[model samples]
Structure formats: C-alpha cells, structure tokens
Target: MRLYLTKAALLAAASLAAQPAFAQESDDLIVVTGAPAPIAIENLPAAAVVIDVDDARVRGDISLDQALADVPGLQVPRSGPIGQQTSIFSGGFESNHTLVLFDGVRIDDPSTPESVFDAGQDTLGDARSIEIVQGPLSALYGSGALGGVVNILPRRGGEGALNPRLEIAGGSFDTLTANAGADGTLDRFRYALNAEGYTSEGYDIVPERIATHDGEKDGADITTLTGVFDYALTDSLAVDLLLRQREARVDYDPGIFGNIAENPGSEIQSDTALWRLGASWALSDALSLRLSGGALETDRVSSDFGVAGDEYHGDRDFADFSATWSITPEWTLLLGAQNEDENIEAVSFGSPVTGEQEHWGAYIATQGVLGPLDVTAAIRQDDFDGFGEEFTWRAGAAYPIGEAARLYASYGTSYRAPSLFERFVPFYGNAALDPERAETWEIGGDARFALFGQTEGLELGALYRASEIEDLIGFAGFAYGNVDRAEIAYAEARIALRPTDWLTARASYANTDAVNAATGVALARRPEESWSATLAAERGAFSGQISWRQIGSRLDTTYDDFGFWAGTAEVESYDILRASAAWAVNDEVKLYIAADNVLDETYEPVNGFAGAPASLLVGIRVTP
Candidate 1:
C-alpha cells in the first residue's frame, strides 16, 4: 500500500507539471430526453445520468453495456460475450419495462419473447451522447417505460471543413475491428456517416460444468452503418434525414434442447433497418412546430443442426408531431401526439402466426420557474387498440440551496403494454394479459465544491427512489400472466473529485432491494449492492485510467447438471478490474492499449452462464 500510494503521488506530480499546457474541457451536457427541450443536467428534478461516447471510447468501452455497467440502479446481464443476448433490468423492473430510443426513434422489437431492445446487439461507435432517466417516465414517453428511459443521440454533422476518422485493429481471440466516420457541412446542407465491423473468435460462454456436450469455440460478428443529413430551405424551415442498418450473427451453445447436446451447431442471426425523415418550422418567436415519421424493420432467425428452427420478424411505422410554445421567457408548453402501427410474425415448426396492434397517444407538458423553484409537469393519454385506455402523469420540482447546491424531488406514473409475442405466441402466451403498471417517486440533491481551481471539480450527488408495480407479468402455470406485484427501492450515491489539475477520481454506489409483493421472492439479476470506482489522469500527450467494479450476490435460477431447467438459487458476488492507457502521437493520431477483467476473476453474470475472461487489445486511431 505504501509503494502504491508513493507511486501514485509521483505520477500525479509529473502529470500536473505538464497539465498547464493543456486546459480542462468545459462541460456542455444539455439533456433533451428528460424534457420537451434541452435543459442543463443540474436543473432536472429527476435523477439522470448523461454519458459522452468519446469518453467511453477512450476508456475502451465499445458496447452500450460496457459503458453503462457502472451506472447506479441499472443491471446489464449478458448471457455470453459479444453477439450474445443481453438484457437490462432497471430498478428491478422487467427488460421491456425500460424504453430505449435511438435518435429520437423507438427501436425495440415487438417479436422478441419479452419485446425489449437488445442492448448488446449494437456498438456505440457512432453514438454521440447517451441520456439515462431513472424512475417512471411513461407520462412523457407513453407506454413501455414503466422503469425508465434510455436515449442515444447519434453523431451530427458539424460546421466548417470535413472531419474523417478511421481505425483498424486485431487483438485477443483473433478479434478484428474496423471503424470509419466522416462529418462535414456544405452551405445549407450537412451530412455525417459512420460504419463499424467487428468479429471475434470467442471462447465458450457456457462452461463445461453446466453444459451437456463438449465446449466449442463460439464465433460472433456485427456490422453497422448510420447516416445523417440535414438541409435548410429557409430561415424558419429545415429538414433532416436519418438512416441505419445493422447485422449480427453469433454461435451459441443452446442447453439441452429435447435431450440434444448443448453445443450442436446452434447460431442466431439478426438484421435491422431503420430510417426517419423530419421537418421543423418556426412560425414565430413563441411557437415552433416539428414533425417526424419513421419506420423500423427487424428480423431474427435461430438455427441448429444446419436448419432454421424458428424465425421472428417485427416492423413499426410511426409519425409524430409536436408544437412548442414559449409563453414567456420563464415558461413553456409542449403539446405532442404520436401514431404508431406495429406487427409481429413468428414461424414455429414451420407454422406462421401473425399479430398486429395500433397505438395512439397525446401528451402535454409545462416547464417553468414557479417562484424560486424549477417545476415541470406532464400528462399523457394512450389508447391501445388491443387493450383499453391508459393515463399517466408526472410532476417534479427543484429548489435551489444557495449557488452550488439544489434539492429536487419527482413523482411519476408509468406503464408497459404486453408485446405481441407475449400475448399471442404458441402455448406460453396469454391473450388476456393486462398492461404492467408502476408508480415511482424520488428525492435527490447535488452540491459542487471547488478545491484548488476550476480544474479541480469536486461534485457530489445522492438520491433515493421508491417504486411499486402492479400486475407485473410473470410466467405462471406454463403460460405468461399478469399475476404478480412488486416493490423496488434503491439508494444511490456518486462522487467525482479532482484532487489535482491532472488527476480525477470518480465513484458510484447503489443498494437496491426488489422483491415480489405477493411471494416475497427476490427479482432475478437485480443485485442488492453494487459499486464502481475509477482513477484517471491526463497530461499533455498521455492519458491513462484504471477502473474497479463489483457486483453483489443475487438470486438467479440455476440449472441441472445436464443443463436442464431448475429453480432459483443464490449466486456469489464478484469483482472485476480494468485498465487502459493512451498516447497521442501527433495532432491527428493516437495509440492505445486496454485490458479487461485484468485479474481474470471467474464469475457468472446470469446464473450459470460464464462471464468473459481476461483480454487485451491495442489499437491506433487516425483523424484527418
């Protein structure tokens, strides 16, 4: 411990000597997903977290799960490595309860077993920013947000000359990656494009001890492309376009399929295509109208023994219109409506079954300064063709405590309509299921204190959220049903301290308790305790970071020795360490190395599925 502390001291001193040449960056994280318009993070009454993708890339986080692993009250359990299925359980709610949006468009697939977004399938190479709003948000986003909302903003074209970026590399597991991006402006026209391809000869995510056959070296790969274009016709009118395509494939060791071996040439393939067009007009200083329409098509296929077993396809088409009225400098009102059509088809044993649904929703929100308090309120009415009517509302207030601190509280109601697959599938589905509903409230505050100078930003925040969910969908008597109630609560604390101009330390901790209200069974994958800490340093031309994360014990379903179905059991707690270093060779070039799971701790994230082992990667990036 003495040696480590002494070495760190010396490094900090050296880095600080060089830091005078490079200034600390300014913070410009104005979040939009939480409100009708962009607002500063500190002004938000609800607990929210915003992440910059550039920072994530520098820290060697390629996927969304890797980047969000440290977020409080969020759990991302990957069944395997890259390309494997991954799901998010936020605030102890189901995966489908959390809504995800990409470039302001919904991308969740309705054909999946749970009708949720696969957080693992896409890479964050093209994302510019991510906003995470914790607690219920269906009042603003409509259904499918009983837990929270995750919004990802793609890169936009910048003004002036073109900027191009390219990177190619290969590392452990015979992994290979290639990335390219370009953005520029041309008079009234602006455009941006990004592409990424990644492949890996991955090890068996399923351990031999729990498998029914010999382990096999699974392989996984993904390719994605995104494009954005904007044009201005007049000072008051503008148009924009967005296009995206993603394809992925992963080999898996399916456990005990009717007495069949686990690693029997099983694989899953998926493809997604999405596009959107939008137009905005400013009628006057007080009113602005925005309209957008988009479509998404997604499909998945699972194969074993060289034959396709099941195929699922889902499609969504939607149009949205909103008018923002600035009644006063300190007050605003936003009125919006959405029309959507979703369809799903599943082919099981060569028999195809299809289902379609329509959703219509209208919402109104107000944001203003009521006296010394920042206040916001919203209400939404939704009509599902298959179901009846639903209503939700949200209200929040923030009170300033002097210049550097604020106290905030929020209360909201949210809901999630059952998916097509969950309601109309073969024997496991129930057609009479009701929508899952939840009510949540939170209280939090933030304070900022400067130590040495502006470079040393010492910030602290803490929050506690309590929630109750009713009619939660659960598997009962061989079919899915809304027969359970649940309670969720979490206390989160965060700190970011810069003791020196060149050194920064950050940490977050969360203690969550989620359980079934009826039976008192703990929710799966939602750990009772978790924490993460990181130490980062930057100098004139060099930067480095070391991170430590820990996941606490939780109850998850276990399997039999032959990989057959079993009951729930307690899972052990585990910890992981990661480190990365980067060197800027010149104005437009950088070299870096990163190590994951440095201690090689053998742990299972989801029940019996094995997590990834220690790995290394080195790469160089060029921007010209």
Candidate 2:
C-alpha cells in the first residue's frame, strides 16, 4: 500500500513536470444553497465542496461518511459500518452544532429526545449529490447551524425516457448490501423510486470482553425505501411530492474497562416515515413563488438485557411550511416555520427512573446578488416550552473573480437545547444543564487554472475558520451539565488536477487547534493535523485508483474505576491505504475489485476501538 501511494504521488509530480500540452476551456457556474445567489467556486468567499451524482456513483456503495472520510475540512467519527457522526468546525462545535438536510428538508432524528441524532442517517444510499458549506449558518438555517450545513440532493427525473440502476455487494465481516432505483418521465409528470438493504456482522475495534463492557458483538442492519413525484400543472405552475421510509435493527457490544463483569446485550429497532408536498408558480420571468409543506413520523425502541437493564420507547411528529420568492433576477426571499411534538418513555429496568417530555420551534431568510457578488442574511426565533425563546442569525457573501474562479465568507450564531438523555434520563439526566450556544466565523476562496494551457483542469482551494462556544453540554459522573466553553481554529487546503483523459489526482492537508477555552483542554475525537492524497488512471474499459489517508494523535477523557477522572489521555495515530479498479466487460456488465487497509494499520478512530484490518472484495454488476 505504501509503495502504491508513493508511486501515485510520484506520478502526480511527473504529470506536473511534464506539462503536457492540451486545450483550455473556461466557464462560470453559480452555486446556490450556500451563498445568496449563484456564484462561481473560484470567487466564492467561503470554504465549500460539491460532490455531484456522477462522482458519488463512481465511489460505489460506501456510506456517505466513508466516501468523504478524507475531505480535509471535515471530521467523521465513525462508529461502525454505516453509523458515524460528521462534524465540521468553524470554531469548535460538535455534531449537534451542525445542521443537516435532505432536499431542503431537515433530517434530524426524533428518537433521542432532541431532534438530533448521530450523523449516520445522513448517509442514506438514495442521495444523488451532496453540498458542504463550512462556516456559521445561524442566519440562513437558524440555531444548531453554527458549524455548517450539509445538503443531500435527491435524484429527480430529467427529460430522458428512463434511467435504471442495480447494485449488489458482499464482503468479509459478514457485510452485504443490495440497492435498486429508477427514474422516468411520463407526459407531464416524472417519478423516481429507490430501495436498499444493508447488513453487517461488523468488526469490533475492542474485543468483546477485554475492553470495558463487551465490545465483540457490535454490528448493524438497516433498510430504506423512497419515492418522488413531480408534475408540471402548467407552463407557470409545478408541484412535487416525496415519501420515504426507513427501518433499522442494531446491536452493539460495549467494551469493559478492566476485568470481565457483565455481558449486557443491546437491541435497538427504529422506524421513520416522512412526506413532503410542494408547489411552484411563476408569476413572471423574474419572479416566482414556491410553497412547501412536510410531515415526519418516527418510532424507536431499545432494550438492554442483563448488567444495566434498560428500555426506551419514543414517538414523534413534525410539520413545517416554507415559501420562497424570487423577487427579481438576483434577489430571493425565504420565509418558513416548523413545529414538532415528541412523546417519549424510558425505564431503567432496574434503576427506578421512568419519565417522559414534550418539545417544538419557528424560522426566516433573504438573499440577493450585486454585480459580481452575492449576499445572504437570515434569522429565527425558537420558543421551547421549558427553555423559553432563543434566537439565531447568519450573514454570508460570495464573489466571482473571473470566468473560472471566486471567494466566499460567512459568520453565524447557533444554540442547542438539552436532549432527553441529558435532561431527564434518570441518573444520567441533569435537568440543571444549560443550553449550548456558540458563535462561528469563516472565510475562504478557490481558484481554477489551466495546467500549461491544457484542457485538463487544475483547481486549488483554501479556508480559515474559528469558533467559540458557551455553556457547552456533555456527560460526566453519569449526569449531564453545562461544561466549560470551547474554542477552535481550523485551516485547510486542497489541490486537484486531471493531467490526462485517463488520469486524475488530488491532495489535501488540514490543521485544527481546538481547546476548551475555559479550562485550556484539547477536544475529543479531533486530530491536530491530517492529510490525504489519491491518484487514478483509466484507459478504455479499465480503470484503477490508489489512495492514502493519515490522522494525527488525539485525546480522550474517561472516568477511572475510582469514579474520579482521567484527563487528556493520548492515543497514537495511524495511516490507511486503499486501491480499487474496474473492467467494463461490455455495456451490460462490469467487474470490480477493491481493497482497504492494505497495510493493515493497527489503529482506531477512537481509543480502545477496533479498526479495519486488510480486506478485499470482488463484485459484478449487470444492467439490461
């Protein structure tokens, strides 16, 4: 693996030195969902990344978090298989500080008492595209958007007659997956449907009884189905409808700290159903109106047998409405409101703490463009029954430099209410915990240039961001409370190039310095520095890529057997290398091979956890 990475890096250098002559192309494409108006990447002032559907498809069946694992500015603390928590730092907020969406709909989990869950769900297989804007987003998305927003774009039907796809894969660790989807248009309407199933025996980072509790039995199984409908009512009117359902059964082994004590088994089952209805009307060429309404329902149950027996059951309903108007060619306004009702019941089969609580919030945004620049501003006031009203806001701007390049910048504020686990879960819940609040700021830019006037493009981007948090929340001594404030600064850069029709290359580097500003302590699950690079070449029906990723040392805090505390514990870092290739036998079939942890690096993303060993997979795809 190391040899392959060295070869790829050398090849990239050679390509740069060769400076092969090729054609040059130029164009300016504006980006929305981040800045107020569409602005070219080169002139966009903030640090952002866009992964289109084509790129996503080429990445195969990897979870969205795994596919983006090496992105310089992002941090994904992988739990196992499809479960991970993805968080971006503007200053130093956790995943709860980030806001995530699917096709403009908030996808936060309703099972955890708070509408937030681990970032794992955001990686559903139906995603067609993903956009990441790193900075404060309070003004645009309201509270809980202090770090950034990640939007997953769904695949909608185009003018084509029909599009269909199928994929199946199996590998070691008892992992298996199957996916199928289709999109088509019929006269005045278009429709899309997708379904997927995934299961894995899972590889334990910590052996079942050796660690803390029992780490050997950690694994997951999940299934999902989605449908989309769109219709053109008239030349000036259109409507869209979306429905989705998900079910999951999960089990994990919690490691023991010292000697074997108890073998507590956890079984969790969850289900979610959601629907969206929307309409768009064109009042004029320069003005349009869009109205959308959505509802979500979720149910979850978890049972832990033996040791610390516990059971949890919960249900939630959410409704939201929003309107967007294009007042002019370059000016847009958005107004929206949301309400959620949650009913939860939890019992510590042995502890004697059983309780339930109910939670709800309403939000607004405006954006415009001026000449070569775009600007956006937004605000929201959330009224929690017990916590009172809290407000958040954000402001951002982007500018285009020339035809192929841009810059972007933004600042925002955010806040998070305590979750049921933190506020009311028996001994673990600290009703006295304070709400988490934060302020984040960021600025960045990117540039595109021809390599020796070659048609193959070379692009470079960089960003600097900082954040400060107050009244942060965490678990300590089996209770939740307001922790010390935190501050973080991060900087990163990336360079990507396509040296030839058959060759592509990329390199990235990042530095993050996060501290508990009040206590001067380092943050958890964060690396001080990280780097990655990849190179690939394709010819005719054959293509292959080799890549390498590295993470720096990290720190974790844990309580000792004495029930005291351990602080700033150190963990070693490690590197991983991977390679993959494919052969298109014909239009109807293809054969592919992939390998990970080629070096079998003995390291964990988290302390005392199991990391992937060297493994390989071979698969085939068939299309009619």
Candidate 3:
C-alpha cells in the first residue's frame, strides 16, 4: 500500500511538471529565523517551512501543535486530548532538543527537568506566521537547537488605516471559544491587540483506569492576551515592544497504569508571561545595529484529590546585541553577543528546592552571493557558569540550475545544555551530566513550472540526519544518573505542489531508527515509519481541505505491578482522517465547519492512553 501511494504521488508530480511553461510573478516571502536579518526564502540554504495565519484558519486549527503536525520530519506526542501535556520531536530527538521562540524570545520553562516548552498552553489567534527550520542550528541560535528551531511571529500594525476581527466557535464535548483583535497605524505609532478565551468539558483519556468512577470527565479553561507597539522615530531608526500572557486550568485523569480508584481528582493551574523591548538603527547605508532584551516568567501548581500538591516558579531574562555590515554588493558580515539568566524554585511534597544558572555567548557569520551560487558560514562560542565553554559551526551552499530550479546542501552542529532541574533537584538530580551534542547534513532541490495552462509550484526534497549523545541522563535505582549512550538516524522525503491559484497539495514520509548503544534496545515512542498528506482548494467565496496522517508500530515500556521494573511492549499502528470547509457570506462575515477523526479510528499516540474520537465544530468570523 505504501509503495502504491508513493508511486501515485510521483506520477501526479511528473504530470504537473510536464505541462508548458507560463510567465508568473516570483514568490517574495521573507524569513527572519535563518540569519541575523530578514532574508528572502529563496536565499536560505536550510530546509524551512512557513505557515501563515490564513493556512490555519482554512484548516480549522486552533493550537500550534495541530498546525505543525503536517510538517515533514516532525512528530507531536500528546498525553491525552487538547489542553494536555504536549511535546514535539524532530529527527528522533527529545522535546528539549528543539528551540521554541515567541516573538524572537525563547520560551523554554526553567522549572522543567529538560526546559521543554508546552504548546498546549497557548492558542494561535494572535500569530501572523510560523517558521520551522529543520537541522542543527546551534551556530546561529545558542543551545537547545540540537534538533531545530520554531519561531512564532506575532501580527503587527501598519497594514491599513483600521482593521478589526472577531470570531466565535463551539464544538463537541461542550467546548466554546471566542477571540477578538484589531491592528492599525496612526502617525508615527502602530499598535496591535488581541484577546481570546476557551472552555471545554473534555472526555476521559484513560478510560480503563477511570471506568470504575461515575462518568468522570476532565475539563479545561484558558485565556490569553497579547499586544504589540511600534514607533518610528525616523526613517533610519525604530522602537518596538511586545507583551503576551496566558492563564490555564486543566483537569486530567490519573496515570494510565495506576490505580485511579484511589486518586479521585487531578488538576493543574498555570500562568505564563512574556515581554520584549527592541530597537534598530541604520548607522550607515552599509552598516546597521540592533539591540533587544526580553523576559519570560512561568508559575504552575498541580494537585491530586486536593492533596499532595506541588508548586513551581521560573523566571528567565535574555538580551541580544548585533551589528551587520555589507562589505560589498556580494558579501555581508554579522557579529552578535547574547546573555541569559535563569532562576527556578520548586516545592514538592513539602520539600523546597531552588537553583540559578547563567550563560554568555558570541558569534560571527558571513554570507556571499556570487553569480548563481550562494554560500554562508558561521561559528559560535558559549560559556556556562559551571560547564566551561563549547563551540559550534555551520556551512551551507546553494546553486540555481535555471530560471525555475535550484539545488541546496548544508552541514551544521548543535547542542543542548543540561537544565537547572536536572542538575540541582533534590533526589533525582545529576550534577555530573554533560551536554547533549548533535551533527546533521542534508541535500535537496526544487523546481517550478506550469500545469493545466496555469503557473504551478513544485518542490521535492530529501534529508538524512544522525545524532549521538555521551553521558545520557536517565532514571536508575530511583536516582538520575549518566547511565547510557544513545544514537539515532533519520531519513525523510517530501513533496509540495500548487497546481493553481486556489489549489495546494503536500505529502511527506519519514523513517527513524534510534537505540541505546549499550542495551541495543529501540528508543520508546520513536516510530519507524510515519506519513502525512493534505489537499486544499478554494474557489470564489468557498474553501475546503482534507488531511490524512498515519504512524507505524513501535516499541514501548510498561512498569510492573509495584511500578518498579520495566518491560517492553509493542504498540499498534493507527491512521486518522479530517476535513473542513468554509464559506464567505460577504466581505465582512464568514462561516466554517470542521470534522476531526472522521473515521472514528481508535488508537493511542502514547501507550495505554486513549485518543480522541470523532468530533465536529462550527464557527463564524467577522472582519472589517
């Protein structure tokens, strides 16, 4: 079946490309995460994918996790349903290996064991675009870039004189949602603001463990507010400010294999806040300077049956200073410095713990464009308070084959530093743990042509990535220790086609092999095979989309009766289907409906945990 599907996709692509060539305007999209300043997408030598707000609205997706699941070589693991613990894995690496940024500020929680970012706590209502860069990028972004980087760009003002949008939605499980926003420009000042609220009476995730109870349901409520302000002092200088906050309360079931009868209720309350201030000045026609500073604060409280609760608090601050100089029309140089400070406090089972850490880094990079060839190289050095210093580097090249084709290749190295919780926690801390390291290389190409008498876009790419870590930290004998070495290899293929102005299609397949070098056992939750596809179209005032995703079988571990020893088990494969449609009633009003899990497939993304069933949602949006 897989072979047949692959062949069909290839045939379709070939047929589309065989048509006559037609003149069309070139794509002018700009991406900011690949370098010190915004650069055209065609100039980037790395594998990157960009999803805009219109794409999410057409697909009826409300969260970042759902919007990113269709990207190639990416996996999202959820503990239960929406508003649950969520993690993203890239190239078979753990969640912490990927760096997440909100408006250019890092969002990793210092209180967590691995400084992982939770995607479930926030919605996508205020986002303008999302950029995903696949591969090691420690040379550009500091630590926590071992796998890749995800950057969320917020909406800004200045597009029009005045703009406002409002939306309301309701769905299965008694869920309700409402959001409103506005943006505009006045004189030298431009501003944007947004607010959102959501609530749901969710379903039980671990039915077998909670079946003895009387129809117990887990529920959740969330609220978010965001604002952006920018002022242009002159044509050569500007100032910007951003603020965002989120509050959430979520109820969840007990552990999958645990005896839920004893624990009646489990819930968590969390609050996250982010703030940033930045300025840019064009010192000369060929020289520019940029400076930015930001802070991220998080607080969380968790409890079971109104007892045995834990409280966690984390605060982090960061600053960046950079200068870019254009030596010639073909060459450019960038130099930057960064600093970060983090503090964490935790109270678990009446025991209190606190820790702090600091880091400093500096980097230099150069990019050159000569004729049809583009080349870039960068190097960075980072120093940790207790871990000394580490260095990383990257190099990439791209060459245009013709007016409508290009070939690119890149090689880079990245790392992930141990978190404060991993080094200073009471009983399960390991101060001797070393930072995880990774290296990756990739090559790919793309082409553009005409199909069905209209201009069309087509891209095909492939990549291979391998990573290894020394002194890997794990739990052993009720204590954290550097017990094993781990390695992983991943390969992926991707295809994207736009046959017309209103039609788009995409398909991707990935295979991963990961194991502990000492035990020779496969890594848990790393599937060997995974595939996804999406088809979308729009005509007149109507738009629709259909998506499919599948995951292959993998190995998992289960604890014994006393929850002490571990044993391996096999998890069956599963597939899902979803569809959505939207109609624009007029210039100011639009209606939409979506169906998730249309086939009602029963499968578990995580072992022993039940997934969501078929559900429906309807919404109306108004803009003026």
Candidate 4:
C-alpha cells in the first residue's frame, strides 16, 4: 500500500508539472438532468459527476464496481463485483450517508436496520447512464442525501426499428450469467425490456483464522427484470410507466476462525419490486406540467444454514409522488412528497421465538431557477413509531460564469436515523442510541475546453466538501453508544480530454480527512488518498481501455490488543491492479475480455478475504 501511494502521488505530480495550462472551455451545454432549465455545470452549487452510455461502453469490460471506481472522493469496495455491496461515503460518513435513486426515486429503506440501499447490483447490467452529486442535498432530495446521491437512468428507446440483444458469460467458481433485452415501438407505443440471471459459487469471504473456513465460503444467485413504456397523446401530452423486480438468494459462510456450532450456517433470499406511473403535459406554449407517482416493496429472509431455527425477515414499502410546473422560460417550480413504511422480525440463532418492530415516515421539496442562477430548497419530517419526529433540510445555488464555466455552492442539514438493526440488533443494538445528524457545505465547478492543439474538447472539474456530524451511533466498550461529534473534509478532481478523434484520456484523484472528535482519534481503514487513470482508443470495429487504480491504507475495526486474540492480528493498507478490453464484431454483436489484478499485486483491502489472484473472463454480446 505504501509503494502504491508513492507511485500514484508521483504520477499526479508529473501530470501537473507538464501542463501547457489552458482555461476550460465554457459553452452553452444543456444541463437538463439535474434542474428544470438547461444550465451549465458551473452554474450549480452542488458538485456532480455524469457518465453517459458512450463512456460506459469504451471503459473496458465494465465491472459494475469498477464503473464507480473513478468518482472523486468516493469509495466502492469490491468483493468480486456483480453481487457484493458497494457502500458510498461522503464527508467521512458510512454507506447509509448517500442516497441511491432510480429516476429520482429513492431506492432505500430509511425505516430498516441499515437505512442505505445497495444499488450497484440492480443498475450495473442495464443502465443507460449514472449521475453522482456530491454534498448535502436535503433541499433537492430530502433525508439520506447527506453524503450525496447516485441516480441511475436505465436504457430506453432504441433507434430505427426493433432492436434486440443477448449476452452470456462464465468464469471462475462456476459463475454463470445470461442477459437479454429489446427495444421497439408498436403502434405509436415505444417500450423497452431487460432481463438477466446469474449464479456463482462465490469465493470464501470469511477471515483466515477458522479451521473450516474453505468450504464455509458463501455464494449467490440473482435474477432481475425491468421494463419501460411510453405513449404520446395528441402530440402535446405523454404518459410513461416503469416497472422492475429483482430477486436474490445468498448463502452464508462465516470466515476461517468462526465456530459452526455457535455461528451456524445461514441463507438469505430477497425480493424487490418497483412501479411508477407519470405524465408530461403541455399546458401552454410556454407552460408545462410533469407528474409522477410510484411505489416500492422489498421482502427478505435470513435463515441459519438451511434450518429455520431463528429467522430474520424484513419488508419495506414506499410511495413517490411529485409535480413539476414550468412557471416560465427562466423559472420552474417543483413540489413533491413521499411516504414510507417498514417492518422487521427475527428469531434467536437457536430458538424459534420471534420479535418484531414497525416504522413509517413522509417528506417534501421544491426548486426553481432565475436566469444564469438556480436555487433549490427542501425539508423532510419523519415519524418513527417509538422515536417520534425528526427533520432534515437543505438549500443551494449555482451561477454560470461563462458559456463553458460555472461557480456553485450549497449548505444543508442531513441525517441518518438508526437502522432497525442498529437500534434493535439482539446483542448489538442500543436503545439509547441517537439518530445521527450532519451539517454540510460544498463548492465546485465544471469547465469544458479545447485540447491537443485545440482540435478536440476536454472536461475538467473539482469539488471541495466538508461536514460536521453529531450524535454518531457507534460501538464502544462492547456496547452501542453515540459519539458526540465527528469531522470530515474531502476533495476530488477529474480530467477527461479527447486528444484525438478516436482516443480519449481521463484521470481522477481524491482525498479524505476524517477524525473522531470524542476519542480524538482518526478512524483507521479509511484510505486517505485514492486515484484512477485510463486511456481509451478506438479504430475500425475495436475499442479498449488501459486503466489503473490504487487505495490507501485503512484501519481495521476488529483491532484488539488483548492477549485473548494475540498473534491473530490484522493488517492495514493494501493495493490492487486490474485491466480489461473488448471488441465489436458487427453492428449488433460484440465480444469482450477482462483480467483482474493484471499485475497480480497481492494484498487485502478487507481483512481475512484473500483478494482474488489474477483472473480472466470472456463474454459475448449479441444485438439484432
């Protein structure tokens, strides 16, 4: 890890030292995705990252986890991609700090044990694009947007006539997959459908100390289905609907030193469903209205091995309803509200008895724009059956300096309420734990400019973020406790240049500084610096990318100096390397290959789980 950091720093320094120094290109680029009008990046106070479908295709054999690898000041730990959890962090908060959304709808359960939802698995295989906004966003999105937001836009509407595709893949551990999709319009009704299924005999995720650790490795199988439909009425009004369902079965294997009798075998199966109905109506030549409403549901169960001795089950349901009115050419207003309900039940590890809890909440928000400036403000008030009421809020603004550059800033209050698990875990939950609160501020801008002799364009941007947190719920002295405060400061920058008509080069760097105010200690295992660089080029029918990434040292939460677990120590700081490529055989067919740990650097990012040695994968995509 030390060597990796040194090399990365040197490389960054070198890039900075040799720059010819050119101002970013400022232009009238449309920014319709985040706000009502087509604003430029420099005009919005919230720092954001956007990845389009074209960028996604040329970036190697996309490992869903790797797709998020380059986002500045962000962390997406990998347990071999596809099926693992990808936690998002901001201003030094945990995974739950960020909000993951699908078409502006939150996909998480604020009423559950772990308030944050894992969107990596659902969006990776069929996404059209992804946008990430860094900083507090309670004004635009309400609670759970404290760290930031990752919104996925799935692929829809294919050009020309009907288009269809199929894909299949197989790799180590008997991992297998099949994906199929189609897009077409019938009688003025355009629609798209995507479906995928995959299974894997996963590598062991347990620590190395247990005797039976090898076979105790866990595995997972998942299937997902999605569809989008749209219809136009009278050429001025349109209705749209979206539906999705995901199912997963995961087997458990406690690591190397775990005792089977005490830990036991475990399995979990989960089902998630979502639906939305909305319409876009033109009220006048200059006025318009967009309305939408949707609902989401999830069901999950965790059992001991295959036995039902003591089971853990949870369910979450939510509704999203919002209205947008284009008040004028330069200004618009949005009013929206959401309602959520959740429930959980669990039995003991060896007993069949059960215990349960229920929770619910609601929230609203509004945003508008004035010429080159835009503003957003929102608030959310939630009510937990036992916890009563809690509120979160935010406000922000953006100003365009030129057609190609903009300046933006924002301030907001966000929060993470105790998850059901955090508040009620049999042996872990603390009844006295308080809901975590955060006050955050952000500033940044994006600029576009000519590059490589002024023949092509380049995009450059940077963001600085800081936050102060209160009542952080954590564990201390074998019991749950609320740490009075925590502080975090972070920064991220990105550079993407189209040096030639057929080639693109890009790089990103990020740094995070965090401290536990109460203990006057810096959290371990939180990498201080991280970076990624890639060069992609294309010719004829072939395209490929060479990429590199490094993660700094992090502290282990399981660290213990006591004699009881002596010599069974943990290590900090590890680095990894991976590379991938692909080729287009025809307009509707393509083939790809990927190699993880290309240099085969051997080190563990997470304790116990031996990162995979160098591995290979080959797959084919067929579209007709």
Which candidate wins on TM-score? Answer: 1
Measured over all alpha carbons after superposition, the RMSD of each candidate to the real structure, in angstroms, is 7.5, 8.0, 6.9, 7.9
Measure candidate 3: CA RMSD. Answer: 6.9
Order the numbered candidates by lDDT, best leading: 1, 3, 2, 4
Candidate 2 per-residue C-alpha lDDT over 214-259 given as tens digits, one digit per residue, 9 for 90 to 100: 4355567888888888899999888888888888776654324432
lDDT tens digits, residue span 24-120, model 3: 1125434231123333444556566667765576566777887777777778877666788888888787778888877657777888867787876
Whole-model lDDT values for every prediction: 0.77, 0.62, 0.73, 0.60
Rank by TM-score (best first) = 1, 3, 2, 4
- lDDT for model 2 comes to 0.62
Q: Which residues of candidate 2, in runs, are more than 4 Å off?
A: 1-39, 82-91, 113-116, 121-124, 207-217, 255-266, 304-309, 314-316, 348-363, 427-434, 455-457, 475-479, 558-568, 586-588
| Candidate 1's TM-score | 0.93
lDDT of 1 by residue, 1-624 (tens): 000011111111111101101111135334231123434445668666667776677677777888777677789988778778788888778777888778667788878877777888788877876767667878778878878767676887886759899977667788887889999899888888999998998877666666454666777899999998878899888888889999999888765454324564888899999998888788887887778888999999999877898899999998887777778877877778888899998896576758888998888877778998888778889998777789999888888887788889989898999888878887787878889999999999888887767533888889999999998887988999988999988898988888888888999899989999888888888889998998999998999999999999998887666666677888899999999998999989988888889999988888667788898888888987
Alpha-carbon TM-score of each model against the true structure: 0.93, 0.84, 0.90, 0.83
Q: Model 2 TM-score?
A: 0.84
Count of residue pairs whose backbone atoms collide, per candidate: 0, 30, 0, 26
Model 1 lDDT on a 0 to 1 scale: 0.77
Model 4, poorest ten-residue lDDT window? Answer: 1-10
What candidate 3 gets wrong by more than 4 Å, as runs, is 1-28, 31-40, 208-215, 255-264, 305-308, 370-372, 476-478, 497-501, 558-566
TM-score between candidate 4 and the true structure? 0.83
The true-structure Cα RMSD of candidate 1 reads 7.5
lDDT of 2 at 128: 66
Winner of 1 and 4 under TM-score? 1
